[model samples]
Target: MSNYTPTKFATALLLSVLLAACGGNDAPAPETPAAEAAGTAVEPTTAEPALDAVEGEPALADAPGGDPAPADPGAPAAAMPADAAGLVAGRDYEEIPGGKPLEPLNGKIEVVEVFNYVCPACAAFQPLVNSWKARLPADVRFTYVPAAFGPRWDPYVRAYYAAEAMGIAERTHDAVFNALHIERTLKGERGEDSPAEIGAFYAKHGVDAKQFASTMASFAVDSKYNRAKQFIVRSQANSTPTMIVNGKYRIKGTSFENMLENTSAMIARVRAQGSAAE
Candidate 1:
């Protein structure tokens, strides 16, 4: 009886291990869930700041926990969102040292998103971005900066610049996202895509496929590529879908919704600072 008991216990443990092993996967599922597709996750009731803290700053902290910090006394009172008061530095956002706008300010508050086409996170963030940007005031400038972190990511950066060169970037942006994340046509993730193949996708949007492919490696596209790399390096943005506000603050929100809210608050902060200077 004692010997049987030991064997039964060992068998039970083996069965549990087998079940866990069968459930695990080294590869991504063929399809992402709808919530993840939208890039939304069930956030905790008590939110904490992200660990992507600023460089040279103390290690990422869980401070200012439970609720956001109160509104900055220096933030402009007018044109600010109600939640702006809850913004806490190092948690909601971080100041970039010696940061400069990727483009000339030209009297506009610049907000740039450093993203990658192969990034599932960026794909999920797109819908939210579309909605948020639509509500932006005329004085605010929103820019999309595609990240070329490696060979797999670089082709899409080229594709973006090439499309922009042909004046088809805005028109084809959503289509590109759909092709990659929703339709699963482009092989950006597998690093199996080429300029010609990607150009073929853009061709459906009225671009000449051959010209599009050629432009991917054009001198102009190369220039944009180099500048983007430099700007990302200097900003210390190591993740896709990172939001930089007025080239001064890098947002690190607790969730997708929180990110947009923080961006709005930062915008107000910049506007207020501008007014004070005047």
Candidate 2:
């Protein structure tokens, strides 16, 4: 973690975002009529400690590899069903101010998932997001931004960046979620795992222990973490599994499935705008 401490203003801003997010006390009521209407199961809210653990064991580093290549962006977008029409802005999604730009700006619309590895809601939403990503058109790009809510959450974010730097993120991303939610090996509470222990988890996935440790602390990983944190703040993403389309709209589906449906519509919406602009 950067020795850099959050300033009072930054901390206040993050707290405000968190309080406004789903995990907060004022979070939306589960099993709302909208969710039932969408035929979606509501995820239960639990009052566990704020911290969650990372999953996996560390192993010796093998040969270095390149970053995971972007998925093919040329496929045609899937069509939205008739029922997916009229997704309202405030109800179904919210628009961001001064929209964020796509990273690497590959001339395609971007979809960003701001999530945390330790969030149970995020874990539950992963498969759905994965399926949605698979169907994305060639003109759309998808990426994940791990949230850093506090010190307890910092290590997992570091782990994500480390794996990315070592080129193992694509292969091991789901495994980390399984470790936390299924295997129950990684804990989220403070002081559960040292940097070395966390490094061991990645090492088990073929990330060299020493190299993983070095990379986790390296300037490169730090830069990525900083960027992710900024994105979360700028996007005002207070909840896990939050989806942003072209960095202009924040999607809010009544149900998990509905969220994906809304995501599809937003992508189409953005694609149309891009075409019109050209």
Candidate 3:
């Protein structure tokens, strides 16, 4: 695990990556001529806080852990009906070559969401993801990985790590989203909030501001944040609100609702495999 210490050079590199990812400010770009002609608004791929991609270029194949294993030829059949709703590997999801969850699961299947608090799409998807998570069986484990695309997003990532360390992540997670998206009190753009400012926000939810600030800069938080970056890279999830199931498959769907449905099917498939193994 790399201990994160912000050097002038590293900070500058991160900021450069951020600028490249967004092309500029946080506003959503206007639809292109082709998109308008097609009668569909072209959702900005990296425009605005929520729509932006991760920092640095995508390097999924070179990520640590190597490539994910090939699909098991003798694998048990998926439990879901092989109908339209059924997830088709490579079509609805891609297997990670060396993809594995951040933490080992003693026996439970792992489901992870790679997201950013500043992302508008993530804010929109939060309630849906939350509802799905609440209904997960005990045999399935769910966790979140906050995206650290650049210096602008570093504070939010630090805030998340600090909250998790303080055991207040769950309590304050939704509140953070609401603060950014609903209330519009917290600006999602980079450089909008200092560590001190973010600490004050957490203080409202019972976290000590001073401790939060200290923790955000601690070696432990840095390690966690670094691990999160690796996970995002390995998952090959370029956009916000992407899901990975069992660290093996990156779920894909035409729409948000489709993605959730696909996720449910994938969870069922993994559960079935575990049961069969037993």
lDDT of 2 at 36: 28
In candidate 2 the C-alpha lDDT for residue 187 amounts to 59
lDDT tens digits, residue span 82-118, model 1 = 3435677777787888877888888898999988766
Tens digit of per-residue lDDT, candidate 3, span 78-145: 75436344677665788887777767877878888887777655655566677778898888889998
**Per-residue lDDT of candidate 2, residues 128-238 (tens digit):** 676678887788878888887656567888889899888999877777766654454665531355677778878888877878877888899888987776666666665
Instruction: Give the CA lDDT, 0 to 100, for residue 61 in model 2.
Output: 30
Which pairs clash in the backbone of model 3? 50-119, 50-120, 67-97, 67-98, 68-96, 68-97, 68-98
Which runs of model 3 end up more than 4 angstroms from their true locations? 1-85, 275-278
For each candidate, the alpha-carbon lDDT, in order, equals 0.69, 0.64, 0.68
Worst 10 residues of 2 by lDDT: 29-38
* Clash totals, every prediction: 1, 19, 7
Candidate 1: give its CA RMSD in angstroms.
14.2
Best by TM-score: 1
How far does residue 99 in candidate 3 sit from its true spot (Å)?
1.3
Better of 2 and 3 by lDDT: 3
